[model samples]
Target: MTSKTTTRGEPAGPSMTYSAIQQPAAMSDAGNVLMNWREWKTLFDCYIIAAGKEKASSREKCALFLHVIGKAGREIFEELDLDDKAKTDYDELVLRFTMHCDPARNVNFERHLFFEIYQGAENLILTQMIRGIKGSYMRERLLAISKLELDDAVSWCRAEEGP
Candidate 1:
């Protein structure tokens, strides 16, 4: 018997169809660049996967990414310090955009701020203890230990008070 196939809406044969992938919205807010980039990048990634372009060549993927990012994104891409080879690399392009979107944090300054807050809390505890102590001698002792280690100050208070 001869093989037969039926088509629901079209002739029975191998066929392929592609729907237009929606472009992600262009980033607009300067203050929210990092947040906007993160959102836009997510949408673009979904677009790539939905369009069956995950296996596309690096150059082609890079081109598609650049195209979908809109005018401002293109400008930012142009400003990125990419070498010739990197220009054709999708991962390199993504890295450059990520760096551009998210600025490097000042680790030293952050550490200093953290220590300042921690020291402030310790000083507050010492000040509160000095105010609440019954004797002037105890208050003086607490004040002296304020400039020393917090653990030392606590141990001094505990030792002077007894069990």
Candidate 2:
């Protein structure tokens, strides 16, 4: 099936791994695709978090995630074999998903925060060109033209440069 909805314009059964999730008939929000933890997180926030008339409880959030996950996704979650506490906690569920599914977690986004200019005759701005960065990475240090004692930050940049 393309999503959880079948070609016949009906909800696919649980047997389908990539089944489209059950959304409110009135709500036009397309439900979670269950491809990866990040995608799930984004869509979950949109659809299950507050998409309904009222706020969904944490319990409902977990159920929503489980409902959308297909056979392979379900297998991964089961393999984690979380205890009741971990299973119940939504944040923990996300953590488990990231641990199991996100492949590039080791590549620190901070390194991409800014590109240090070695020398500048013109106006100097410590420029950052972090492509595909998820969250904010701006600071006074990033904007300042004056020399700053940012040993750690310089180290991160230099590491990328190499010998």
Model 2 C-alpha lDDT per residue in residues 1-163, reported as the tens digit of each score: 2667778766777554433544532212244333445555566566663446136666667777676655556677788989988887777887887777755543455333322234342222223322222334434433343544345445645665588
Q: What tens-digit string does per-residue lDDT give for candidate 1 at 52-163? A: 8999999999999988888889999889968999999999999999999998989989866776787687765665666788888977866765366667767877999799
Q: In model 2, which runs have C-alpha deviations exceeding 4 angstroms?
A: 1-35, 103-163
Clashing residue pairs in candidate 1 (N, C-alpha, C atoms within 3 angstroms): none
After best superposition, candidate 2 residue 34: deviation in angstroms? Answer: 11
Clashes of 1: 0
Which numbered prediction scores highest in TM-score against the true structure?
1
**In model 1, how large is the Cα lDDT of residue 24?**
74
Cα TM-score of candidate 1 = 0.60
